[model samples]
Target: MALCVMMFLLVIPASLAQEDMDDKVFLFPKDKHTDHVSLTPNITKPLEKFSVCLYFFRDFLRNLNLFSLASPGTGNTFYFADSSSTNTVHMNQDSALFRTNMEPYEWKHACVTWNSDTGVVKLWVNGKLYPRRVCMKGSSIPAETSMVLGQKQDSFEKKSTTYPFVGEISDVHMWDYVLTPEEMLQALNKNAHGNIINWNSLLYEIKGDILVLPKSRCPYQITSKSYVDNGEDVDNGEDVDNGEDVDNGEDVDNGEDVDNGEDVDNGEDVDNGEDVDNGEDVDNGEDVDNGQGCL
Candidate 1:
């Protein structure tokens, strides 16, 4: 049962193997540090109305790039950056929305949903909705553009490391439509799946000394359900009272009185109810006669 819970709750995580991932980081010198994710088609793509979400845990209070989905010269430019530790949301040519509550050294669920028709952008941080307007304002993201992560992109090949991300990022998802606040909350629970980028089986490339780390806590969990007995029975998959248990509505005596009873397999019943569930009950419904009853 514990193993089943563990399986549903976690998959042992790719970040748990980050010790081996060190060999894959760009490993640039500290004097000139750089860490980024070079976007392949699967990482980022152009869309008119879209929403993207990711889970990030920053290790330091430095500037960093979260996502850079923009064309340098001729397309709609939309980007997110942690400039000087201030989470800045940018769209189009130099328009930006600044956010100031993101904490360093913590895991955060960040989501941005945008629509080109209205140029409206909605940012969700850990499931809280923050709405804005008219940033890109009727421009479509270029189909073939430079998309990068972990560093602010000045251009396709030219990215600024002044805010190079130093930490772990995971659970990235992108949908071609704006996600509602409830849907964004579901993302925090890892309940929702992205049609564009499913983080469970993601394909991307990481650069520099950025190390992927396991999430500090499991993103999903199963809560024990309460039985029908109201608060009368514990929710440990069993019900001892009027409530129905997950196994069935089997009744269990608490032994508070001397006549308390135990679970009946082939046990006796005082009411002559023939608690008999085997033999004829198990064998062709003949009779209570011997029919070689097996559990």
Candidate 2:
């Protein structure tokens, strides 16, 4: 009996527990109809107000399903999609379209919040909050639902083949209440996490062709920054200031060299008494008549 129990425990998947998914991403390589990620949240009660946020990097501008939450009757209980011209957030089958310019093949951060009491919905993209709109006025999302990424879930059915996401997605989170502006900023910076679906301790199962991989970030970091009286080389991938501050390739002190033919100390090279100010050679206060002008 003991051996059997141990074997059964070993066969159980890690998705059954909270996972630390920080600094990781879900990569949907292609538009496979069955490819999706099923997320499990800890909420067992209906939510009157909620917020969802994620970061996505895509190359194509076609129909893309960012997040989907489906209940018994409403497939789009809370769905978010993106296109070239606009981003739409749905609540209980009703959606609000937010028109904004989206850049292709770049990482974009999006956050959506909805309150059933007021039916007001707000969308923020890359830390900029857009105009608010209202949807699903008094309806709350049922707790018995299916949440997914990469494709939309229709009443627990994965049927978003045409609108499958094609790129990388990371830092997916959801809260039971609408986050304030300061809280949202903290979420964008990874300083805050969701209580309902925390990305740091997420519980998820990968299906089909989805890839769980580490996120792309710069490996090198600047440890410290300081201004030195003596010349020092800073190779931390940042600009360095030498003894004389150079602005736009021009010396600030004006006593240093300039490439635009501005001479030092009135064209005298190093104050050595060489008459190079006017580019004409004269012998020590003696003017040579070069036939163009005579003394």
Candidate 3:
């Protein structure tokens, strides 16, 4: 997962102390979707005009949250997926025009801008400008923003979380004012600094098991029902032996045997033992092999 975020066009020179840590890769474990990074508030006076930018990547459409901004009464929810679309860009308590198509498993840049002067909000994906939306006109977001990332918050101070993002994210940046197309293009091409949350000097805290990778090679293994092989839905999280693809309905219901194999039943009780997983046999489902191997 790589999120390449940039800010204003003018790249300000910073001290050696203000650089992104070489530790760029932060891996959130699949088992711990509740994990998140809580950022200290950006105490920059009037929270009127601002934009949140980042790069993200994932392979599933499972209601992943990208960011949130909550005020006293009104708030905005930025998310990736909903019940409607797989790759969506949605906002809350706003208007009707807020949706975009974002592909998965590839790095893509996204930015959302809100201006209180005109109560206009806009979103940009890659380099395209989406339609401007009307919301919170002439009003500033609460100075004390209940900001959150990688999870959806339904209330201020992040009181409720209904959706948690499961993927890799990076290069987060926030700007106090909207960036011009030229500035946006410059930031997209060159390096820039964030008035607020700079990826280079990011201030954040991690919760739960989030693997921070300093290298490009990943060592974690994931085995699940969604694993696909050459357009075949053959893997339902079951084990395979000696490079042999054995899931062809050979061990259930009919108890029929077409060839020599293990776990083949003959209507007579055959309780095959639990299958080995991660070097351990984990029992699941009912073992009715009459006297068979697995129950």
Candidate 4:
């Protein structure tokens, strides 16, 4: 029975561990040496060109590694990272620096693509493309590899905690070839699927302090809901209140019955006069002057 059970366990495919992680995020709560995520791509052949896309958010003002792919020979086979002030991308132990201003506590979308024929590297941040660079011309990234997030792997047997990632990361995808601009936009809009590694159907394992949670915001869903809510608010609050109740019930009717001298003896006219004076002097004239001048 023990032999049968062992055989059953051994026969279990590694793909069985994969889970659909659509609309989910990997939250790295803090920078810990042991905290990391292992990604399984099951790549059978080496890749001469590839693209990687992910969205990340950080409140910590420090450098962090976003993606790391390590092979038997090269540890920094493909590494993506960013600092508090700038961004850096590594391919085959060669790296390029990008002087892009990073806003604190803000979520950012980054996509990187590399072609070995020309050794050209391209980076897109939040749908904006950065200047192109080249590295490791004609080199191919090996397959049967180990990939991780939240930490950088230096070698097949060793990993580095230097520039460990903190905060949240989501929507990770990897393609076997460089994505076209349209495909990149589709990926950014969450409309494209990756052939190599799909976020919607991901094979990943958390090694340490990583939490898989629902993403905080869905852009299209949130925007659509907001438009619906805004429509309802405007229809109910503005049209009904301003057109019918406020205009007819309060403004027109009450203007004639109370404010158009009907309630003059009740101090309505005197209060109106005072309000008008205050409005013109303080609210309209001085307020605008002070606001424009001070600003």
What is the RMSD of candidate 1? 15.8
Q: How well does each candidate superpose onto the true structure, as a TM-score? A: 0.58, 0.71, 0.59, 0.71
The number of clashing residue pairs in each candidate reads: 4, 0, 21, 0
In order, the Cα lDDT scores of the candidates are: 0.56, 0.74, 0.55, 0.74
Q: Is candidate 1 or candidate 4 better by TM-score?
A: 4
- For model 1, residues 97-181, the per-residue Cα lDDT tens digits are 6565676644577888888888888777777776565666676776666666666666655666465665566666778789987
User: Residue by residue across 1-295, what tens digits does model 3's lDDT show?
Assistant: 1233344322432311244643374565563556776665556586777777776655566557766666556545433332224334444555434556655554556777777788777777776787877776776665666666676556665534566666666667788888888766655543555687777776566766765555243222233333222222223344443343344455433344333345444332222332223232222122112111110
- Residues 247-275 of candidate 2: C-alpha lDDT, one tens digit per residue: 44344446645323445442233222222
- Which 10 consecutive residues of model 2 have the lowest summed lDDT? 286-295
> How would you encode candidate 4's per-residue C-alpha lDDT over 84-165 as one tens digit per residue?
8788898876898887887755678899999999999999987899999998889998787888988889887367968789
Top candidate on lDDT is 2
Please rank every candidate by lDDT, starting with the best.
2, 4, 1, 3
Among residues 3 or more apart in sequence or in different chains, the pairs in candidate 4 whose N, CA or C atoms overlap within 3 Å are none
